[model samples]
Target chain A: MDDETRALIDALVADARESPADLARQTGLSAEEVEARLADLEESGVLRGYSAVVDWDRTDETGVEAVLEVNVELDRETAYDDVARRIAESPLVDTMRLVSGDYDFEVYVRAGSMGAVSRFVSEEVAPLPAVTSTVTHFAMETYKERGVLFDDGDDDDRLSVTP
Target chain B: MSDETGSEAADRSDGTAPPDPADSVEGSDQSDPAEASDPTGEGETTAGDRFTAADRVARVPPSGIRAFFEVAEAHDDVVSLGVGEPDFSAPWPARSAAVASLERGRTSYTANRGTAELRRAIAGRVERYGHAYDPDEEVLVTTGASEAVDLAFRAFVDPGDTVALPTPTYVSYEPGVTFAGGDPLAVPTYHEDDWALTPEALAEAGADEAEMLVLCYPNNPTGATMSADELDAVAAFCVDNDLLVVSDEIYAALTYDGDHESVATRPGMRERTVVINGFSKAYAMTGLRLGYALAPPGAIEAMTTVHQYGMLSAPTTAQHAAVAAIERCDDEVARMRREYDRRRRYLTARLRELGLAVAEPSGAFYAFPRVTDVAPDGDDEAFATDLLDEVGVAAVPGSAFGSGGAGHLRLSYATGMGELKEATRRLERYLDGR
Candidate 1:
């Protein structure tokens, strides 16, 4: 690869969230070169993660961010796709992740306000057939923002990739 | 974590609280924890892609200005200082000229290069800045400065061309470049230098093979102006590199310090610069949708031909009105500029009082103040949004203009002095609330 392609990959690693064309231009690389390197990196597990850079002010102002930990009551006949689709349609839910441990699913929601969060749970999530119970946790502060860490920071606090 | 067995997932068992659907998907996965279960049961086939559906309909999230407007939309009782649209009507002479054109039944399309009279007026106007153009060949009237901006990019840039921009500049520049299939290379201008784009930064951005240089002054978000000496240096650089300059001087007449400098005036520059200006800011005619571009004859021909195929012509009556605006609205322009100057002074003082790091804006109707002085870790987009939610006043985030906009908010003084004062009062209350 050329120097420009290397610089492009370095920038992409710095943020880990840039579009291929954007990374290419910033690093003075051709878009094709950037795309090829990105594909190689993805195949090798060098670029393993991508996440949103939340504008906390806009998010907090428009809605409240809540991590809803849900414990599902297991059943054979229950329609899981129908339930997931219902949650996905609601404007309040920003991201929904399936996690390990006691909770079956971790859902991140952003409501218009604290009141809106309660209303959304009561009106939308409550009506779903297969759901059992949920526990909500509000984020207090983001101590270290995503895509802003490098070698100087501790590996534990920073995001790392396994090759 | 409760280890609930299957068959307990039929309905809401916990009667006290509402059961969220997210739990049901989780419950199904847990029923067979060892075997991977697809929530959709199609094993990876969804009815429609969740990601694609969400991405297709995604909205440009509510900025501080938009959020405030939404609130004002619901509550008419709320005295809104929201949205930076100028409160003044198009000056009387321009309005009457438009009315006269309607009476005379001048509603049909004019030439794609615009009504000859208006094109002549634009040429005459540019001549004052020492940038002369051939009205018949080098000027093409667009729907507005917005269209001219897009046309300039479309005319000069091919796919993958890099267009250098100075930040905190116009919000529309980057998007316009993108629409024309060009990448925006935003060169950050420091607040300490009054947001001037220096020769060094310009040279660095231009070092690569690029098709266009997008310049706006007196700038939008920062309200910064480049002096004649600065303009000369930029013009020389463009000439040396054989790069086209897309100059957006919509706020040219609104300069407070002195006459606005046009880079097109420099030697061997007019042939390479497309000068974009409009009747919007100068005559308080934002709704009129009238603007024109003066480029080298060949580029103007291409742009005018594009207009012929795409737009046909600008509004007929607005073109007539624009002719009158250029001919007779000198006094009205001066008056509005004076009012804006007063508001600029008042806002600069208020920003300083609020402990914002700000320099006096020399041109345009905006004051870009650094909000980090009060909230060190404050995000421009976040702080501005929260400020609107808490207080009624609205301002755009600095980053909307370009990369150098972090930790800053752009306050437009285009409203009345009383409204500007009220906005400052609301900002103070918002600071205290935080």
Candidate 2:
């Protein structure tokens, strides 16, 4: 396997309660190398702890995801982080990044409905000094779901089984 | 594949000046036509060993497409529209004339500017289309329009000069431009405009820092031709902006509908425009490797200088054949042109009937239709690749041309009518699944 695939194996063993062999079987890696690599990673504090990958989609929280492309006010003297924090403090804001070109930032904000999103934009998002014009695009139906990339037989088999 | 070793540059680069076209060995022998077809082996070397092994050699990892062609070639029952060349033999008169030249042993090198007789013939031919040229000073015979294009780039463009070209163009233009150390500026020609190069777009292209602008009429891939007014506008734009125009009119004589006009024929445009023409299309002599360019005297001299250093001249015997062919404008060329025109008409109608948005092809032997017009999100390359893979048809993907060709497919109707019908049938079946 390539270098990226090796690192992925070590990360899997440290984070989730999966054995090196299981990870190997899941990612098409050699079981022996996976075990040895994981041992070395743990000794270096690289393998930290096991955590669960919770099904956020099935959770009680009903949040709608939308993309917000922000064009910064050219006259404003405020820095990027100033606007970032204002949006980040709201629990609805999931991700934000400073970007190039016509837009200064891309904000991924999760709220309830269109009305609720409008409310957040007007009250919480618009009032900020560093704020600029925002264009919103709603999420359409997903044709392919994104998840952990696994190609080995075991991962395919495990995915086939429903909880 | 052969053990014959020349200068590393000769093997790796195509920029070196070639040998004299008048070399006897480069001519056709009536006894062996294949011998005449050999590309001249002299002046084939370069001075510097600059590139690494990887840079010099092309790695031929298995090509599924080539493999398919190999398999297809073995079958006698297989009717193929896969190949993109005329199925007819070189017109008998042209062949006979070529044989006569070989028999006469007029196999010596001609002037770098080409023979007086052949140049006069080319001049006469161009004059018929309203483009006046001095055969002695303006024209230089080369090895097909392909070589003329390569020479155009090398002679006119400096290291950073951008050569603007409309996309959905011939595949060779980009590589040739790059080989000349120039950048290829691809302007997207969409199906919405029926693939016409708009005046606004042409103006912008000329306004760009590009030193050269290329236009192919009876265009390849799209089979679209610019109208007389369009040609005039383009010529005016190029003249205004001082961009050298390279008009490839190889398929000029094959226009199906009406008269074929050259941009060089426009008022005051001949000086700036390089008219590239060849026998490959009209005479159905693809294997002959013969073509010519009519440029301004200075451009002709520059191209000859480059040709001398890199490629000395076009094949000698082919030049003689060309002289004979041009001298006698027989019914053979006219007959072939009529046949191609018939094929062009039939193919476009059939494609439109199939529900593909085929732009009415006024010229050339190609029919480029938008694939997504029938199948949405239909990747043209995948569609073409899969078609060849499953059903065994070998049309090129329009994407191979440029970005403007994203959802299009280029089908050549140069083959026999029977093969064309079979290809259309297969296409119909393929689209039926969609």
Worst 10 residues of 2 chain B by lDDT: B1-10
How accurate locally, in lDDT, is each candidate?
0.67, 0.65
Report the number of backbone clashes for model 2: 9
Q: Write model 1 residue lDDT over B250-361, tens digit each, in one string.
A: 8888787778988888898888888888877778776577778888889998887777887899889999999899999888887677566656766776677678888668
Please report how far candidate 1 places residue A15 from its true position, in Å. Answer: 53
Docking class of 1: incorrect
lDDT by residue (B1-434, candidate 2, tens digit) is 00000111122232231221111111211122223222222232234423232210121121222233334544444435444445566676677887888898877776776778888888897777887788878889877777787789889988788899988776556656766777788876667776878668866655456688888887876878888787777777777778888988888877866789888888878788888988777776655777889988999999999877766767777776776677665577776665565566557766776888888777777788888655445788677666665667776567756778888877777675556768878878877886
Model 1 Cα interface RMS deviation (Å): 22.8
The lDDT, on a scale of 0 to 1, for candidate 2 is: 0.65
lDDT at B132 for candidate 2?
Answer: 74
Error of 1 at A130 (Å): 99
TM-score (chain B) for model 2? Answer: 0.83
